[model samples]
Each structure stands twice: as structure tokens, then as C-alpha cells.
Target: MKKTARIAAVGVIATLALTACGSREDDGDKKGSSSNSDSTSSSAPTDASSPTEAAEQYPDFKACMVSDSGGFDDKSFNQTSHDGLVNAVDKYGMQTAEVESNDPSQFKDNIQAMVDQGCNSITTVGFLLADDTLASAKKHKDIDYSIVDFAYFDDKGNNTAPANLKGLTFNTAQPSFLAGYLAAAKTKSGVVGTFGGLNIPTVTIFMDGFVQGVDYYNEENGTDVQVLGWDRDKKDGSFTNDFESTTKGQNVAEELITQGADIIFPVAGPAGLGGLQAAKDNGAWGIWVDTDGCVSAAEYCDILLTSVMKGMDVAVEQGIADAAGGTFSNEPYSGTLDNGGVALAPYGPNADIDSDLSAKIDDLKQQIIDGTITVETP
Candidate 1:
């Protein structure tokens, strides 16, 4: 049997220096790039048991997942979360099922299909699916349900989820702040930019941290690197209005480039690929989100500076494991700098960042982890 491990709440930061190649065969059907790492546990399982053994161990346990509108190939959170479900199937030999939602209208039906299929634990990807996931969880109180990028709380700050539901959320603003600082340091034009797929909290949280990081860099270095496409105070900025349109992404990026933004950050999932293309064509640097661009979209490696990543796969696999092992809890799992749940990818090989700036970014990470610095969220 594969040994079960709880995802740690705190740990030493994981090294993220990686190199890989990826391809995009179609503009509309792009898939996320790939990378590898163990779970947060100090002694995470290193080998998988035979399928026979796995089934025998968890004969009645079946895990299922539902993807948001971006589908599993989004090259962002959906892909990463799907990877976690696959990891759990491989490690635990548990039975699994999955469905993709091509639109918001399918959320309820997709989740209901999993429940009807007799899934003991269901994991839903994306913040947009929260209401549907909650409804399903409430109706099927015996089944465990976990949603990515969302927590079960109200405006007044009270937990409203059923005892069987858990949230798999990440504080990505922390790492995006680091990415912003790096962009500020590397931009020759003295300007950087960021845009999101939507104005939602999950998307804007990245923008919030990034703009703040630029501000911090200006404060410390006496440099006034301006940020375009986002204004933190107004809580407003540019957005693609959707996560699947590369055309919109590219157009928004071009607008920022035209405004003298030499570095562009796109938090728009598959749509962000267009932004990267825009940066490459315009001779600007690009910063990717959710996964390392070099690994997820290697064709743009030459122009990518780095990536702000959330360890969704690690958390998702562990959440399923908890359900399978009878150790499930409804407490929300928040990925943060202190917990190795979110990180800034190492500078790309062709990136202009130097040793001094790299070291400074590392110092910033440590400070954030140690509470010497605080990164606000939207």
C-alpha cells in the first residue's frame, strides 16, 4: 500500500530551478506544460504499488474531479489540479472519474454526475464552481467535496461549508509580489504590467501582489518603476473578461507594450499564452502564472522571465489521500510562502536578471515567509 502523508502547513521552500520544453499545436486548444515534484510531506511516497494491491486496499473508495470552463488543458490551475487527481490514482490505486465543464451552466450537472457515479470524494477545480460544489456537498453530506481556489466563508468571516467540504486555496499574491520585484529590477523601460482573465478575487489576488511588489522595489531602490494594466487602490484594471481567449490576451498585452511596458505578466490561464506571444513579438519579457512557462509553454522560453506557481497538484493529491485514508477534515488548506505551497520559478536561462537581483529576490521570499513582510490579497 502507498503510505499516506498529510500535506504540511509549513516547510523549507522547495527549489524551483527547472528546464523543459513544450508545444502548442493549436491556439485554441493549448495545454499546460509539465514539471515534477514530490508532495509537501517530508517522507512522501516514492513508489507506487501494483494496481491490484491499490484496489484491494481501497476497494470502496473512489475519487472524482470536475474541471472549470477552461477544461483540463488550460495550462493553468485546471491542468495542475487534474494532475493531482492523476497522481492520487497512480499512488493509491484508487478508482477515479473526471468531467470537464465547457461553460458555467454545466457546473451543477458535472458535479451531480460525479455524485451519481458514487464518488466517495469529489474535487472541483476553479473558484467559479464554488456554489455548485457547495450545493452538491450539502445534498450529499456523506461524500467529501473539495474545491480549488475557494474557501467556505461569508463576508462576515464565518465558515459556511458542510463538515465534509474543504477548500484548496493558495496565497499566490506572495510569489507574484516576488515576480513583480524581479520584473521591476530587470525592466530597462522602467515599466512593467499585469492583467487578469477576470476581475474575480482569485485572479486579482495575483495583480494585487504584483503591483505591491513593484511599489516595494521603488521604495527600497529609489526607483520609480511604473505598473500598467492595474491600479491596486481603485481595485480596477484591465482584464480579458474570460480565461480562454488568446486573442483578447494578446490585444491587452499589445496595449501595455505600446504604453512602454517592457515586462508583461498575464494571469489569464490559456489565454495568457497570447500575452506571452505578444511579449515575444514586441521584444518584451513575459511572466507566466500557475506553472513555469518554460515547462508549460517552452516555445516562449526565450522571452519568459519566470513564473509564479501554485502547488495545486501537491495539495489536491493530499486532499484525496485524506479522504481515502479516513483522516479527512473540513479545515481549509491555504498554500502560502511559509508552507511551500506557492513559489516564484527560477529565472529563465535567457532572462536578463543578474546574481545580485536574484539574491535580493530570495531575501524577499525569506522575509515574506518569516512575517517580516506582508503580502495583501484581494
Candidate 2:
């Protein structure tokens, strides 16, 4: 039987560092886990998770997840990735574990802790974890690993998936273009805006597609609906600097709204909630990312327009299930429209979108899927 140890919240990086050091030796010698330590008031996991679930159910397969600095309750991207692992926990009745990195520096140590705890397979969330996940995968060849939003490439840029590691990627630009078009068509103000958590490829990809969508709308309708916060040709735009601060999110959205943007899209993960709040406070409609905001961030549902879906739940669930069934492979999985890996969420039921516009949106989706339209991302 696997022992299930309860974990309190892990609040700070310093405390987690100490715990990692103190628990190091014993960690490698143990087969069980210390679950759910949310030590910080600010970094706390909003909902408590079962420290360990039915370890005895799948003795040979133990799964784990390591979150980026944003933690699991970001209510958007990271949460979607984590949900996949939780799905496996419920469906396969496997022993599961998770560690939320309160800081970037803690990523490696957190991964080490999961390995020490004997996680057979581990999934690291977001592009920020790519390098650390690669290093760990190299060091621990016996365990399987997967990364979300990053592809494995050598220093020379050759596509590669190191031994025992898989890369989960998405062509989200495909669907985000659809969203951009929607915003352009629906904007009562002639301007819309988008901002990211950082300027990484994964974050900027959405921005690229959005601006292009707006541009496409202009060419098609001869209207000058402008985009704020991003300039695709320059590959530069607005970034919140971090994924965890709602204040920064609110500030950015407030700034863009003040600049006459009535439709807002925030890709800042947890911090994006600040934008959701700002949109509500300032009379702007919001477009969500990763998961459906109306479902994940139900508090802001009434003001949500739609979401550029990443299908993280579907992808992560598939990865874990593949590992559990002994068919795990390191081949990269790219979520594209053809395979339902990426999509645009439907407009809210009570939204002002008329039947004709809705029909047009539907037509655009088919065009993209059929390759009549191509969405590009940097």
C-alpha cells in the first residue's frame, strides 16, 4: 500500500527550498508522498486537493504534475493543464501527486521532489518549464515526462524529443484568428486589445493571430478597427511581466479600455482575472483564453464574450491515459483544428451576437479547417 501524507499550503519559495533540502534524502527512499502544502497566504491553492488518491488502485502507475509559478488556481491555462491529470485520477483510479512552483527558481527542485516521491510519469505546465523539464528528463531517463506549450528542439534548432519526454504543443493561432475576427465584427468601439503574461512564443502566438484577424476584417469590410497592446510586424506588445498578478492585469486592461478599446482579450493566465474584473468595472466585454472563462471563472461569466480554446484538458488527459495504458510515446502532439486540439468557444447565450454574425463565425471556422484561410503565429 502507498502511504498518503497530507500537505499543508507552501507559501514561499524560501520555505519550499528548505522543505526540499530537508526532505531530499528521505524523498528518494520513499514510495509514498507528502501532498498539498500551500504555505503562503498569497500563493495558496484556492481549493484543497486530495493529497493522494487510491494509491493501491494502480500500484504500478503513479502520476504527478508540476505547475509553473502561476500555481493551479489561475482559473485559466495552468488550471486547464492540471485538470487533465485530475481527470486521470478519477478515471483510472491512479495514485496522483502535484507540486505548484511558487517561483521560477523552484521548478527544478519541485520536479526533483516529484521524482523522489516516485512519480512514474510527470507533466510540467507552460512554456516556462521547458528547459528545466528537459534537464530533468535527461537526468531521470527511467521516468516519462511531457511538457505543455513547448516543443523539444536541440541547441541547433533540430526538432527532438529527448529520451522519455514528450512535447505537447498547439497551433492556437488558428482559432485565435477566429476570435480576432469576432472581436472586430462585434466591436461597438472601433478598437480591441490584447495583452500577454510575457512575450514568449506561446503568448505572442495568440497576439499575432488576433491582430491579423483584425486586419483581415479591415481588408474584407474596408473598416479601420485597430488593435492595441501588440504589433505583429515588430513582434512586440503589452506584457504583464508575470502571470500571477491581478493588479497588473487590471491596470493593463484599464489602460487599454481608456484608450477606447471596448473588447478586451487577456492572455495573462491568473492575472487575466484582473482584466475580467476591469472589463466588468469599465463596461468592456472580455475574451477568455485556455478554458471557457464562463465555466472556469464563473464570477465573470456575464461579461465574457467567448474563449480561444487550447484543449489542454483533452491533450493532458490523452497524454496521461497513454502513459497509463503502456503506449506512451515521445512523439510531439500539436493541437490543430483538424484534430480538435484547438477551437473557439461559442458566443455566450445572452451575448448580443446576432444569428447572421453567428452563422458567419461558423463559416469562418470551416474555412480555417479546410485550409481556405491560414492563420499564422510567431
Candidate 3:
């Protein structure tokens, strides 16, 4: 994912670019741009997508990425996936490119663009593309395709059910356990909170591991720290339905703080920024998601107790390596804390957490990784 600074930079670029475009648009309007609009709008849809014949006709040897609707500068999932593509380019000298989807309808168009550009292997970076990923794979059967954070299956054995496709997923709960335990240990208010961006499996999987960690801690250490935001026991915790609403995130965190929760983990994307701000203002601590918030968002970095680190880079690296070796498998590969795919971000102010508690959490981490302890995801 992009660092917060980079996202901020992108915002500036978008603004400057928009201003320049506005000026040009104004001048064009005076020059009778009605015809230009008519031609552009009329031709846009047909030209938006490359034909299957064109994709089949192109030579394929490069790697490409079709980001989720969030785009490459979202500073979260989309950005992290882009980092993986960048790594592939640097290490393999592989030609690489990326396209952002503004909505679900653009999924196929984005994929087709890369395919027509002769990319042999392409990565789709979100679960929202589940249907489109499979459909495109069938249409372009000869291409090697990989989808991150999603899986798809079709009843037909024709082009859609190809063996050349690989789906990348991870056991996010392992690192989430560490986040929950850290929140539990660092809370001065004796209560903690967590919320998700959406109710999807990818997001709730984190909650599952977090609840297990909190429950395990209370059970083993006799700490009656009440989790305030989401009910880990029920497996249905606080969720904002969308990831872009900062006000909702802030409100949720505020309520949790009112209930004595001094630490909050918000698994929402940019919306989580609100939770962090709330934590800071309300004298609470917070946990970040996916990437390292401490480094990603340096302004609020210090307030981040820690982050649930998911090794998207490692997973992406493995996918590219597999494609190169011609050994990519459709079998879902899961990355765990032990497998080096996920874990807890380094402690900041909570670095000096209770030695005994820290050791216990470490032991639990190892147990979960080694199959001795099971961390259930809701």
C-alpha cells in the first residue's frame, strides 16, 4: 500500500491536474466543444474494452495489474498490490503496467487493456473482481492470471475453469491476534474496541483472530478487560458498511471511548484514519491495518499502538515466482504469522508493555503458527 505521505502527494497531483484540465476544458468550450463531447461520449464505451480477438492476437510476456475501485493511490490494498508489481519489475526486469478501476463495470475493460498490451500474467487486486476475474480468465484462456483477496468458481468447464489461474489469500487472524493482545495490554481504560470497513470475509477474518486473542488473554491472565466496540464473542462486531466514511469511524471510536475503551483497532481503509484521530483526541490508543501505519501515516504514527501486518508483498512475490516457474497452483495458499505472511507491527509507545504479558502473547503467537493454538476467524 502507499504511505500516507504518498497518498497526500497524489491528492496534490490530482488537484493540480484537475485545474489544468479545467482550464483546457474552458478554452475548448469556447471553441464549440459540443462535437468533441458527442464524439468522445459516443465512442468511449465501444473503445473502452479490447476485443477478445485482439487479446488473442497480441504477444504476451509482461506483467500487469488491474487495481480495485480504490485505485493505486488508496494507500491500502490497491497500493500494496502495486508495490508487488513494482518489485516484480525491479527484480525480473519484467515490463509492467497498471490500470485503476473506477467501478466494477471497469474490471473487464482494465483487464482487457493489459491483455491487449501483451501482458502474459495479470493480477487483479480486490475481491470485488471475483466475477470479472473468472469471466476474463475464460475469455482469455491462454493468459496466466492471478487474483488477490478473492476467489471465483464457475459451473462451466469451458474457458472459465482454467488451471492457469491462481488465487492468493492469507490467514489474517494471526497478526490480528497480536493487535488485539497489544490493545488489551496497553489500554489504561481496561477496555478496547475494533471495527471493520465492511462485513466481507477479508475484513471479518481479522476480527475473528482479534477476538480469539482477547479471549485467550482474559482467560489465561485473569484480566477482565471488556472489549467495547465489537462483540468478539458473537463474532459480529462493529462495522461501518463502507470504508470511506471517516465520520462513521470517528463516531464508533468515540462511543467505544465513552464506554471506557482506551484502545481501538479499525480495520477500515482510509476510514480508519478517523478512528486514529478519535483515539488521539479521546486519549486512547489505536491499531492500524494491512500495512504499517506507523511508517505509512507518520503524523498519526506515534498514536498507532501497532498494526496488523499482512505480508501482501511476500504473497505477491511468490505468485510472480510461481508464474515464472510454470508451477502456479489453483490451490488456495494461506499465509500465516509463522509462514512469514502476517504478524504484528512493532510496538511503539507500547514497546515497554508488561514483560510477562508480552512473553505470553509471543508464546501464543508461536502456538497459533505451529498448530498448537487455533485462532478462529469469524
- Give the alpha-carbon lDDT of every model: 0.79, 0.76, 0.64
lDDT ranking from best candidate downward: 1, 2, 3
Better of 2 and 3 by TM-score: 2
TM-score of 3: 0.78
For each candidate in turn, the TM-score is 0.86, 0.85, 0.78
Which ranges in model 2 have alpha carbons more than 4 Å from their true place? Answer: 1-57, 154-158
- lDDT, model 2: 0.76
Clashes of each: 2, 11, 2
Clashing pairs in 3: 1-80, 138-159
Q: Indicate the residue-level lDDT of 19 in model 1.
A: 22
Which ranges of candidate 1 are over 4 A from the true structure? 1-32, 35-56
Which candidate wins on lDDT?
Answer: 1
lDDT of 1 by residue, 1-378 (tens): 322222211111122222212122232322234533223432221121123334446655788888787766666777778778767776677776667666787778778877877889999999999999998888998999989999998899788788999999999999999989888988999989889999999999999999999999999999999999988889899999988889999999999999999999999988898899999999999999987666667788778888888888888888999999989999999988888888876667678566677778889988998999999875
